[model samples]
Target: MSGPLRLIELRPSPNNIKVRLGLRLKGCEFETIPVALDDAERAEVLRLSGQPLTPVLLDGDLPVWDSAAILRHLDTIAPHEPIFFGRTRERIHEVERWERWARGVVYDTFTIVPGMAFRGAFDPAEVERANAEMRRHTARIEEALADRDYLLGDAPTAADLTLVPMVFSTMLTEEQAAASRIAAFLRQHFHLGEERDRTRAWVERLMAHWH
Candidate 1:
């Protein structure tokens, strides 16, 4: 009778996972339109959103693209259970700081590994370079998780959800996500727990509806 909240997701992309995690957190149900993300579909998405990126959320006439923007949009619809903020502003800042580090350094470094590993045409030297970059970031994260149960505090936050796709996918081939401190952090804190259920459900739902 009614259309699902249309969410366009690009497969094989951590950016798409970011919004999927966000929507799962909000408990927002949506119809996913799986976009192939090949040259043709990428151009189509670019024409629609003015960029060739993944995880574009379109509700009625409103268009929300980018993982961060989608997350923010969800927050507006459901603010009581805030993902980015907590009881205090400091808490929000802390989450933002870690989230920035995740995407900027950790995810940026570790994100490329799985793609290279899975792609048939990948160069061995490039994969080695990616692994080295990821190892360095993993060590950093392992140190960060030495004491904290999660990235922000005892509870998982926006930062944790955002970081999961990249970290989890990196270890998709049964390898450790990172090295030294950051690797330990991912294994101990990120590998399991509630977020896993949420993310799994999201992917399953997408598969069922988006296809």
Candidate 2:
């Protein structure tokens, strides 16, 4: 790369967190440009990536948008600590499958309650439904972790980085909640509770290891 990497992001977003964690894990030094949810900021994103997305990574003159793409770029540039867990074809496929599930199924279910809360249209019944769905997804994660320490065995991969932040959002500490209302709202409405002991412990373990 010709210059320092710049990550344009919304700090609390799980996708942004994923890319940030990937960068940190790879020992890549980068600047974080925090963006807000406003038209001007969105337009700036559009100007850079031709899309209105917060997690656009400026790799010198090249603009890489999307969290997965950014992580891939990081792996290419800094391959010492591979986010996709090395270049074995089968391992790469497995990691990509987990990433797909995390982004599509897990994040889709997880975002519903927060989306509603952020819109100022809180519905108790709808929130409950969304919470139940999140729990179901968490249960899947719990089961996935039953056999291994991390999602794909001993080490944290892109899969773990992608998924854990979204799950961790629900079980924020007092400090995290105090710092962000969105965290506070997620903790209040989407907490996994003691029923997801394994998942909660896994999240705590990963957060301690990575964050």
Model 1 C-alpha lDDT per residue in residues 1-211, reported as the tens digit of each score: 0234678887556778777766665667787777864456586677666776777887765768877777767777667564554557888688788778877887666644444433534465755676666556555555555566555555556676666666554433224434333343334323322323334333343333211
lDDT of 2 at 143: 89
lDDT of 2 by residue, 15-67 (tens): 88888878877878888777885446487788777898869999888999988
TM-scores for every candidate against the unseen true structure: 0.68, 0.90
Error of 1 at 120 (Å): 5.9
Model 1 scores what on Cα lDDT?
0.60
Candidate 2 residue pairs in clash (backbone atoms < 3 Å): none
RMSD value for candidate 1 = 8.2
TM-score of 1: 0.68
Pairs of residues clashing in candidate 1: 138-182, 138-183, 139-182, 141-182, 142-181, 142-182, 143-181
